[model samples]
Target: MITRTQLVGAWSLESYTETDVQSGEVSYPMGRHPEGLILYTFDGYMSAQLGSGRRDRFKGQDPYGASSEEYTAAGRSYIAYSGPFYFDESNGRLEHEMFVSFFPNWQGQRQVRIAAIDDDRLHLGPDRPMPFNGRLKTASLIWKRALPNS
Candidate 1:
């Protein structure tokens, strides 16, 4: 079991990769360079925000006034969720219960993640196969502890 000291904090995204089950091929679902944050709090709450590196900006500054194409583009590249989390001490599995999600289907969803930390890196995933586009692939995400004020 990982100590709370090592697990609770703001972590910055380093890489997000998915490996295909049948072909054993690796891919980056959020473009080659993705950016994001995953936060674990002492109060058992967790939040995640992930985005592709290449996101297009809308022509209009007003979000509510954005065109359908702009709205769709943004939604396709970003994923966000927040909710309570339970980390099992005996099994070392982390369960994230999504109270809110940008993806409507994920609201009230519970996902079990395989989590591990070594040195300054935290590895998370294989939380069942993640569907990207139309294909399902096992995701492997790497995160590094966010330095203070960074």
Candidate 2:
């Protein structure tokens, strides 16, 4: 059985794909090689960030100077949130409490994910359907353990 201690570390995104519940179509919102990192701290805090394969730079390399269009483009390709998190050993699930988020709606929300680790990879499941380009889809996120710099 996996314990809370096993989850305390940095995990690198391996893949993120959304599958339609009805039609069974899979979509990669962040391309095949998107970048993301999820971290868990012993102090009971957690944070996650997932970015599209590549992002465009803001005008003059200054975000404050960017126009609304630039901001919209940037925001569309990123997913970020952070807060205290807890693990339920009996159920092997994680309750991710979002104190803040790039998507305003997630703030103050507690999201549950079925968690598993197989062959050194962490799989978060119970992929619930959500809006995806006008259709409902479930996201499947796969993560690998982050290794220290060699």
Candidate 3:
């Protein structure tokens, strides 16, 4: 049983893999080498941001001034959300009670993940396949603890 205390800190993304429920086709949601950060605070708040490793730069320097194509590209390649989080140590479950998210539909959602920690790495995944793109797929994400200076 992993305690909340053991999870308070920043973790760097190692991988994000998805498996199609029907076809068993495994794919990378954020490319072969994605980038992300998941942070947990002692205050019980958590946030996560994951993105494709290679994102094209917007034509304009100002973020708000990017072209529609750039905005679409950016939107398609990133996922972010934050909210209060809790751990059910006995069940090995982590819950994210999302207050907000990049996908508006997920706001106010209670996302549950089965989690395990080995060495400095954290593995998280849903118990069953959830919707992605337009189908059901199970996703497993791996994260590694950040170094003190990282």
Candidate 4:
């Protein structure tokens, strides 16, 4: 059974890949050189940071034509959310019920994440298909457990 203790500490994003359902093309979100860090603590605190990238877009901009300004703004933005997390070992899933989110728009939303854990690596993605704009899509995020002192 997956326990909270097992998920304590920090994790670094290893890769982020997604497929555009409409275009039938695969995209490496953080690109071949993705940068991000996600830290999850047993005490129900979580923080995430994503770096600047060509694919990063603003709220109303076309994701396909995301500009450097948007990317820069997103890179500098620090997102922090605190909530309780539950793990369902039988189904290999993790759910986070957010009480407060740095992105005010996400406050009070419950985000469910399906995960696959192997050794020191954790792979996470949306529990269900995400509707991007108006199309269904999926995102694959890979994370590596950070050493205690690192």
Candidate 5:
């Protein structure tokens, strides 16, 4: 049986490879980045920092036709959200009740995550529906155990 104690620690994302359902292509957005970290403690404290990549064309362009800038806001590119988190051993699930979010719109929301723990990696997938481009899609995340003192 999986227990919460087994998941208590700081983990860094080793790779984030996803397949675009529409195009059937694989993409690795978070590869070899130290800025990604997920912490789960026994005291019910949880924090997650997801690194951001280059913005897509539409995301970086301004409606007013302003010159696009590269790496100007890249340094601040990261998704950070933290709050109280709970673990349900019966179903092997982790729920994150978000208090603060970098997106500002996700504040005060509970994100249910279905977690799968293995010998060296932990795969977390969203249990709730995620709206993408006005459509609901499933979002999955993976984290590898960070060696102690590494």
Candidate 6:
């Protein structure tokens, strides 16, 4: 079983894959090469920020003052959430009780993912397929422990 202490740290996104349940097709939601960070605090707080490998830059220099088109593109290429996390060793599950999320619908939702911890690598995915676009898809996210400097 993976202990909570072992999970406290920053993890870099290695890969994010989405599989179509019916057709068994695999796709990368964040492009072929994505970049992100998932951070777990000692106090049980956690946050995740994921982005597409390539994204269009905002026309304006100030990020906070971006134009509508810039904001639209940025929002569509990024994903982020933050909240408290809990581990159920007995069930081998990890629940991210989201306090805030890019999708407002998930703000008070608990995202429960199957936990698979292997040394410095952690693989998390949903037990069943969830609705995505117009089909049912399952996601598996691989993460590696971040170095101290990261």
Q: Which of 2 and 4 is ahead in TM-score?
A: 2
Question: Over the full model, what C-alpha lDDT does candidate 6 score relative to the true structure?
Answer: 0.88
Kindly report which residue pairs in candidate 3 clash with one another. none
lDDT of 3 by residue, 31-117 (tens): 999999999999999999999999999987898999899999999999999999988777778998789899999999998888888
lDDT of 6 by residue, 3-66 (tens): 8888889999999999999999999889888999999998989999998999999877897999
Which sections of candidate 1 miss by over 4 Å?
Answer: none
lDDT of 4 at 131: 61
Report every candidate's CA lDDT. 0.90, 0.88, 0.92, 0.69, 0.71, 0.88
Q: TM-score of every model? A: 0.94, 0.93, 0.96, 0.69, 0.73, 0.92
Q: Taking the tens digit of each residue's C-alpha lDDT, what string does model 2 give over 30-147?
A: 8899899999999999999998989888877776888999999999899999999989788777889999999999999998887888867888754377787789888889999999
- Candidate 1, position 16, lDDT: 92
Residue-wise C-alpha lDDT for candidate 4, range 1-150, written one tens digit per residue = 455666667888787776666787666655666666777776676766654344434767575566788756664443356676767667666877677776677778778887777888888888776764366778788889976683
RMSD after CA superposition, every candidate: 1.4, 1.4, 1.1, 6.5, 5.9, 1.5
With candidate 1 superimposed using the best TM-score fit, by how many Å does residue 118's alpha carbon deviate from the native?
Answer: 1.1
Best-to-worst order by lDDT is 3, 1, 6, 2, 5, 4
Query: What is the Cα-based TM-score of model 4?
Result: 0.69
| lDDT (tens digit, per residue) of candidate 1 on 99-150 | 9999999999999999999888999995788776677789999999999884
Q: After best superposition, candidate 2 residue 102: deviation in angstroms?
A: 0.3
Using lDDT as the measure, name the better of candidate 1 and candidate 4: 1
Which ranges in model 4 have alpha carbons more than 4 Å from their true place? 53-82
Candidate 5: deviation at residue 82, Å?
A: 0.5
